[model samples]
Target chain A: MFTAFRDHIEKNFPQLLSKPGIVACSGGVDSVVLAHLCTQTGMQISLAHCNFRLRGSDSEEDELFVKKLAEQLDIPQFITHFDTNEYAAAHKLSIQMAARELRYQWFAELMDKEELSWVLTAHHLDDSLETFLINLSRGTGIEGLSGIPPDSNGIIRPLLAFSRAEILQYAREQGIKWREDSSNEETKYLRNKIRHELVPVLKELHPTFLENFRKTQVFLSESAQILSDYTAQLKENLFVPYHQGYKISISSLQELDPLRGYLYELFKEYGFHSWNVMEALLTAMSGKEIHSKTHRLI
Target chain B: MFTAFRDHIEKNFPQLLSKPGIVACSGGVDSVVLAHLCTQTGMQISLAHCNFRLRGSDSEEDELFVKKLAEQLDIPQFITHFDTNEYAAAHKLSIQMAARELRYQWFAELMDKEELSWVLTAHHLDDSLETFLINLSRGTGIEGLSGIPPDSNGIIRPLLAFSRAEILQYAREQGIKWREDSSNEETKYLRNKIRHELVPVLKELHPTFLENFRKTQVFLSESAQILSDYTAQLKENLFVPYHQGYKISISSLQELDPLRGYLYELFKEYGFHSWNVMEALLTAMSGKEIHSKTHRLI
Candidate 1:
């Protein structure tokens, strides 16, 4: 597990260890393992935990466990408690969204306070796969199908290279102890349904479904890059920049292969679902002032 | 009806007089009416029809009816008959897809043969609405939510300015004779399902659903254009064009806002699903070399 963690950091994030960072250690199996690996790798790290106060005693206990673990590892620990349910109600957000917002906000705060260069998390490959499936079920375009990123801004996931099974094996092999969140087992949440039900069925259909899906994402990512380049060229030829928006000469645009994939991408940039909008706009050209809900392209 | 059709042409197809075109006329109310309007307006036009041969005598009757209609109007007529089921079987395409392919192919051919500039169809507002709902049910993104085009390549829909109700009303007022295709009543096809079942339910829920949806498409189209422009600028700064594909500087990309919509559009151009792939990619960057099923991004 330690070797995999170290290798993942080296391979995915070559400069990860060069910067000071805060580890979002929740004392859960995934994060605890990450904390242990960071220490073992001799990286400068601080631990931060957010007690969402969802499970009352369980939440507090989880925070205390992380605090003790931090002491044992000789790392500075920052902890916070929040009325997550109240936040959810006030913001008209789902509990899950509320918790995510709070966690990220708190992590950002901790990073600033400690002057950390990066905020590290322990989202593994399995989590990425789960997210891919969830998004797929929700009627996404190709972009939605691409799955999660390994890094963004100063936020990073150093353990995403390993699967949950691999992480668990590593934790056991290294004699690492961690807490389990009971909520993870509940099927009420969409993610939990995906994790516990949908994925298992999908796995039965294709043993390597998760791995294959991830692979598909990589190909899609590469393809997206090429199409974007083409769109850039097309834009240079057809679009004139304006202060508020742009002026796309209908005649110039008419010269393009209407089926060119990049054209769709270009359309998407203007907040249009390029394909349908282009089709509609192109079709509208034969009619008088075609109006849509918000705008008219005459 | 003729006045509305001429007005539509004047407003939408400002350059229609410069182009000679073929009207895709079946002896149907919509196309027959459209053909009559074009003739009355003295727009150079020829009649084109596809006989899918699905209705035995009825199919032949429709063809004979169109031929007589063209003759009566003193317009040159083009006709093609096809064993649609056989074509579907040979091409391994659904009957609807096969029929569509055949129709468009024949229309294009007639356009070339007659030296016509454009191939005109009778698709109108109601057809556009049905397409939007169908795409939406199939889980389309913004692009899919937009309805059909009025002009694609050299193909144009001069009647798209009016709704189906308007077309029927116009036909009644003009005393136009038309043959109704029995297949339209068959709900086995997805398009038919949308027209017969889904549309009524939707109309009940929102009386102006079709109009509203069309409006939404126009808004999205404008938005898509703006986003494409922004992405082009961003791409100029970050992408290094290579012999085969381009390379994105990780550092430059990292500096952008996480919600940079244009970046997603740019990625989509490369055949990638912009947002999800970027998210997964960014997430993967924090870890060691994560191998998805097919490709590995370090």
Candidate 2:
């Protein structure tokens, strides 16, 4: 496990070994193991903890455990508190979304103050699987099924290559003590239901579901990159800038098979979701227009 | 329902209206509704039934239902029987796989004999969803998630756009009587478990799950098509025919962003599934070769 972790960092994230980063510790086994692996691999990282205060004393204990670990390792520790429910109410967001916003916001501030290169999170293969299932059920394009990327923006997740079982095994072998989040056991949430029920059944159906899922994600991500490149090239060929707006060649667009799909790919970022309206634009009046929330096509 | 069915045919399968075709009827609500729609649309389609005999008397009843439906529609009917269990054992395939193989093989022969333009099947959106889930669980690439194609070889699935609920409603509205295959309700099989257990939960997760799923499939299929085109272009550039084999340029292959992924896309058809050895081949000694079941890379 150590060798694989070391090799992974060396291959994918060698910069972490020289530059300092912030590790977001949830006091769960996933994050704790991540921090441990970072240290073992000679990567410079500090522990950062968020006390959302949703789990009362369990939240406090989680913060305390993370602080003690930082002290034991003699590294920097950053802690933040949030009244998550109040924030959720104020923002009209779910508790999970509120916590996520608060956590990332704080991580940004910490990174700015501490001069950290990246913020490392402990999202594992199982988390990606849960996310894949959630997005699939909710209905998503290739981007949604591509799994959680190892590197996104200023955040990096090195543990994504490993499964939850592997993380648990590593923690056990290394005698790592971590606080368990009680909420994870509650199957009321959709993600929990997927993790607890759907994932186990998927695993039972295949001996290497997680491993195969990881491979599938690689294909999806690469395919997504290729498509994005193709779409960009197509956009370059079709869209000609004219007086602060680009005139798209309808004839060129019509040449593509499944024109609606191509239109969706090219203009989806502009917030247009109505395939009917976008498709109809091809045959509509010369001056007829379509408006998305962010952009307009005339 | 009739108008939508007619519009669907006119837009996508207009050739079916002008030419004669064979409808593979399973004596279920889906196929019965499809056969009715074809007749109503003035499409010349004859019903073809395959009694796999796996369900004993139920198979006989299904065949009888299909035969009556054909008689009522005033179209020619073709029927075939196979001892599916014995075939499965001999072929070392599951009963479902064996039945599928027999059905398609018989359909091909029938098409050849009857001078049919296409073999139509009643594989609706739900069946595609089931197949997608199965492929996803078993680990597959983008092609797996793209869902079942509306047209494959001479077999065409016109009902891919409609949901099972819509098909059922159509059948009821048209007073189209069909047999209920008792085996569909048995959760012992993986496909049944997915259909009965997984699909309902998925639908409950979102109000327009199936509708959105259809849209997602469109995006996936387009993405798959784009990637396939890109792969073909890459293959043309990198592979030069030399004597009896293609001389693949290693430098061009290595220039790909994710070499292993590109390698998999390019050589996967050659039956090479060992990605590790394939990647290692890049840096291995010159003239060292890797052999797949059907092809060799030197």
Candidate 3:
């Protein structure tokens, strides 16, 4: 498992190993395994811990646990505290949202100041599936189905390929002790509900659900990237820039089999959501124009 | 609900109303509602029924119910019985697959014989979700995530925008008599298991799950279409014909942000399944060539 983890990183993210990066550890099995693997691979790495102060002493223990692990591994460590509830209230956000904002903002600053090349988060396959189900229930697009990306901006998830069970098994075999956040067990939160209630049933129904999702995720991600690159090229090849926005040839577009999709690819950025309105434009009399917030397609 | 159904068809599939079409009815509430609505809209329509004979007397009752309904509505009806088990054994296919093949093949012949423009089925929103879950359990790409398509290959699903509950409620209000397939209630089938055991839980957790999936499906379908178009265009622009197959410039490909997607788009038809092996080819020594049964990319 460790070899697979290391090999995946080397194959997919070789540049990551060349840089001095920080691992965001919550003293959980996922993060501990990631830290251990990075050290075992002899990568230049450090530790970053954020005490959101949401779980009373549990938050402090998480920070302390990470600190000791970092010291034992002879890696540099950084720790910070935040009044999470206050931050959430002041920002008019959920506690989870506030923590995400606070830690990511802090991590960005630390990455720059401490000369760290990348910030690593321990988001595993199970977390990816949970996020997928969460996005499914909530309104989302194709990109949302892509789930938690492996690398985005300056942040990376080296453990994203591993499942929670794999991390737990590795920790047990390696005799690694880590703190568990009690709040994770509470099912009041949607993510927790998914992790605890929904995921197990899916796993039971299809034993290879996670591996299959991994395969689907790869296909989805590649297809999505191709769509992105295609759209970039389409802007140059298809659309002719006009006064305010662009004028797509009505006759040319109508020739496209899926008129709705063509209209969406062309006009979605202009903020038109309804296919009904756009479909009408295709057959509407010439000189008719669609007025959107940012642009127009006639 | 009927108004929305009529409006959705008028906006999306005006071609169906332009000519006479046949509805494939199982005498279920879903198809009964659809048949009522299509005639209600004054469309040129007929009824086609297939009795797979899987449920003995129940199958005969279903045929009788549909025949009576057609007679009452003053519409032409077509009904046939199939030796499904024999067909399944001969074709070396599951009973369901054999039924699907027999029906669709028959539908095609009927369409041609009757000069029908389209074939309608009563697949609805819940069915689409069940299919999405089923496809997720099985490995699939972005197109699989797109869910049950509203229209495909001359087959139109007029009730696709409505849910089963809506169909039942509409049937009750309209005094529509329909037969329920006993096989649908059997949870041994993967689809039934999903419909019975999973959907209700999802609905409880998120009331808008169906609507949200509808929205996501549109985006995925559009994005998937765009990717296909883009990749087709890429092949013409990027790759050069070399030897028996093709040659992609290594320097140009390496400059691409993601080499895997580009290579997949380039070489997928050649039948290379492993992206990792193909990706290694970009940096591999000049003599190394990737092989598939039909073609090679060096």
Candidate 4:
């Protein structure tokens, strides 16, 4: 595990090892394992902890555990508390969404303030699989099924190639202690249900389910990148700038096979999603229009 | 259901209506519903049934049911029987695989003999979802996750756009009678287990689960097509014909982002799946060769 971690960092994230970064630690096994690995690999990293106060004393204990670990490892530590429930109510967001938004926002701010080049998270392959399932359950495009990326913006997920089982095994082997988040056991959340129920069944069906999923995700992400590149070229040829907006040649668009799919991808960023209406606009009488919340096509 | 089926046919399979085709019937509700829809849509069609003889009298009953349905619909009928167990033992295949092989091979022969332009199947949205889960559980790339193709070769799945629920409702509404495949309820098969257990949970997660799956599949298939097109262009530039085989430019291949993925896709048809070894070949000694079962890359 240690060798793999070092090789992974060296191969894919050499910049991470050369510069200072922060590990977003929850004091959970995954983050704890990540922190251990990062330090062992000689990466300059600090611990960052969030106390949403949802679990009361458990939250404080988690914060304390992180602080103690930072002290033991002789690393800098940062901690913050959020009025999560109040924020969720005020922003009309679910508690999970509120926490995520607050967490990432703080991570970005901390990275800038602390002169950190990377903000590493402990999202492993299982988390990616869970997110993949979540997106798949609700129906999503290739990007949604592509799983959590290893690197996006300045944020990095170095543990993404490892599975949850591998992380747990690593923690146990190293005699590492971590706080168990009680909420994780609650199946009321769809993710928890999938993690606890769905994933086990899938794992049982194949010994290399997670590994296969990881490879599949790589293929999908690459395919998505290829499509993005192709669309960028297509946009260059099709979207000629007009007075205020771009004039697209409908005939050229029609010439593309799976026109509706290409149309969706090309116009999706413009807020157009009613695919049927968008498709209809192609063959509708001239001057026919379709409007999204932010954009219109005529 | 009827309107959706009609629209799907008119939009995707209009050619089937203009020419004669055969519907692969198992005396199941899905196929029965498809047969009714194709006939109602004014498609000249016949019923083709394969009795693998695995279900004793039930298999005979299914064949009889399909025969009676063809008579009722006033269409030509073709029936064939296979010693599925014997075939499985002889071919060293699972019973299910043996049955599938026999069924498709017979369908192809029947199509050739009867001069049918198309061979239609009753594969629906749920079946696609089940197949997706099955492939995912076993680990697969985009093509596996793209769900079943609606049209492959001369085979047309006109019912692919509809769900199993929709098919059942249509059959009930039309007062159509069909034989029950007791084997479908057995959880021993991976597909059946996923269909019975995982699908219900996924459906519970979203009201439009099947619709979302269908839409996602469209995006994936389109993305796969785009990648395939891009790779075809890459091959044209990089794979120079030399004597007996093509000599690929290693540096040109290396120039691809996600180089291993591109390598995998480009050489997968040549049977190279050890991506790491293939990547190594790029920098290996000039004459070093990587051998697949059939092909060798030097």
TM-score between predicted and true chain B, model 4:
0.93
Can you list each candidate's DockQ? 0.03, 0.53, 0.50, 0.63
Residue lDDT tens for model 3, A143-259:
778889999998898777888899899899999888877777762477777776777767766879889988778778877777776666666766787776565665676776466
Question: Residue B29 deviation, candidate 2, in Å?
Answer: 3.5
Give residue B278's lDDT in candidate 2 (0 to 100): 65
Residue by residue across A1-298, what tens digits does model 1's lDDT show? Answer: 6776688677767776788788898889999998988989888888989888888788888999999999999998888888999999999999989999998988887778777888888888778766754543343444554456667777888766677888899889888899998677662466775566545544543456555555554544443444455567767877787765566676666555433334456666645555555665577657554344555445
lDDT of 4 at A190: 83
Span of ten consecutive residues with least summed lDDT in model 1 chain B? B288-297
In terms of docking quality, model 4 is: medium
Off by over 4 Å in 2: A1-3, A52-61, A81-95, A172-175, A182-188, A240-247, A274-280, A283-285, A288-294, B1-3, B53-61, B82-98, B169-175, B182-188, B241-245, B270-295
| Backbone atom clashes (below 3 Å) for every candidate | 57, 0, 0, 0
lDDT for model 1, on a 0 to 1 scale? 0.71
Q: Can you tell me which runs of candidate 4 are displaced by over 4 Å?
A: A53-58, A83-92, A182-188, A240-247, A269-271, A274-298, B55-57, B83-95, B173-175, B182-188, B241-247, B274-280, B283-285, B288-298
lDDT (Cα, tens digit) per residue for candidate 2, span B70-114? 989999999999999999999999988998999999999988998
State the weakest 10-residue window (summed lDDT) of model 3 chain A.
A274-283
Model 3 error, position A114 (Å): 1.8
Q: Rank the candidates by TM-score, best first.
A: 4, 2, 3, 1
Model 3 residue runs over 4 Å out of place are A185-188, A237-298, B238-298
Clashing pairs for predicted structure model 4, backbone only: none
lDDT by residue (tens digit), candidate 2, A54-83: 987888889999999999878889998999
Error at B200, model 4, angstroms: 1.9
Lowest lDDT sum, 10 consecutive residues, model 4 chain B, at B274-283
Predictions in order: lDDT? 0.71, 0.85, 0.81, 0.86
Summarize candidate 3's per-residue lDDT along B213-282 as a digit string, tens digits: 7777877787777777777877786678876656666676666556676676656666875474465564
Total clashing pairs in model 1: 57
